[model samples]
Target: MSPSPPLPKERRIRWGYWRSMMKIELTRQNVHNEFAKKVELISGQNLFACYQCGNCTAGCPVAFGMEVGPHQVIRYTLLGLEEEALGVNTFWLCASCLQCTSRCPKGIDIARVMDALRTVVLRKKERKDHVRIPEFPEGFLEKVPQIAFVSGFRKFLS
Candidate 1:
């Protein structure tokens, strides 16, 4: 049989980069933290149901721009790695189109999970006094009425 062709240099480099992901030691306490519980409560989805099928990430339209992607965020949450899960911009970049939700074989509402993550990140105890609107997408400001933006800012900003 013929030997397999050697991978291109760039492909090999990319493989190495993926192989260098951070390692974490999981424990019962860390895996059952309040953050994970809150996420499940807010999202009303079973975090343990996901089996890392990669379907959600594969179907996400903006996954390319995300630092961690949806699946990784869920994994981090399940492992009670709140800081790591919240640190990535994956939840912020979510388009909320439900593409990932639709593609999930486990029937998880991935969009809701993203929303819950956003809520947790934005409403941290230290930042509760300061509320601000998230950055509107390009062309969104132009399309939305000024009064709506004004009312929302006034209500949220307090």
Candidate 2:
């Protein structure tokens, strides 16, 4: 049989390959940052345990309106992209219903994580970038502090 030509070597890496590689490197670096440690400490949850199962996404009612879904938020948490995760409107939009927490196969307290992300975002003043929904019910922020104070006092008494 005639000798076949040798298979051609790939002369250039595709853009997708470079993008994926960059994303992976960024995720690795993010996971090792101080903000990630702070997030874990404040949330009292191990973000690294998540496997991106999408249960949180399925449970999120506002995820459809978010730039990043709940599952992506969890992934961002695991990747340690604290600013990106917290800066996103998704964290602010969380209803704190605990559906994500209840549905997580790994038993990750996703609701707690959302609360932690919100606290961090507020502390950093990143809420300035959050999209304002005119349809959002009034007196939302007013109720939160009262609830938090009551809860804190209850805890203190306990």
What is the TM-score of each predicted model, taking all chains together? 0.68, 0.63
Distance from true position, residue 118, model 1, in Å?
A: 0.4
In candidate 1, what are the lDDT values of residues 5-113, reduced to their tens digit?
Answer: 9998656757566666655777888788888899999889998899999999999999999998799999999998888999999987887789999999889999999
Angstrom error at residue 65, model 2: 1.7
Backbone atom clashes (below 3 Å) for every candidate:
0, 0
Model 1: residues with Cα > 4 Å off, grouped in runs: 1-26, 128-158
**What are the root-mean-square deviations of the candidates from the true structure over C-alphas?**
7.0, 9.2
Per-residue lDDT, model 2, residue 106, is 90
What is the C-alpha lDDT profile of model 2 across 102-131, one tens digit per residue?
Answer: 989998888788777766765565335443
lDDT of 1 at 50: 94
| Local distance difference test, candidate 1 | 0.83
lDDT of 2: 0.72
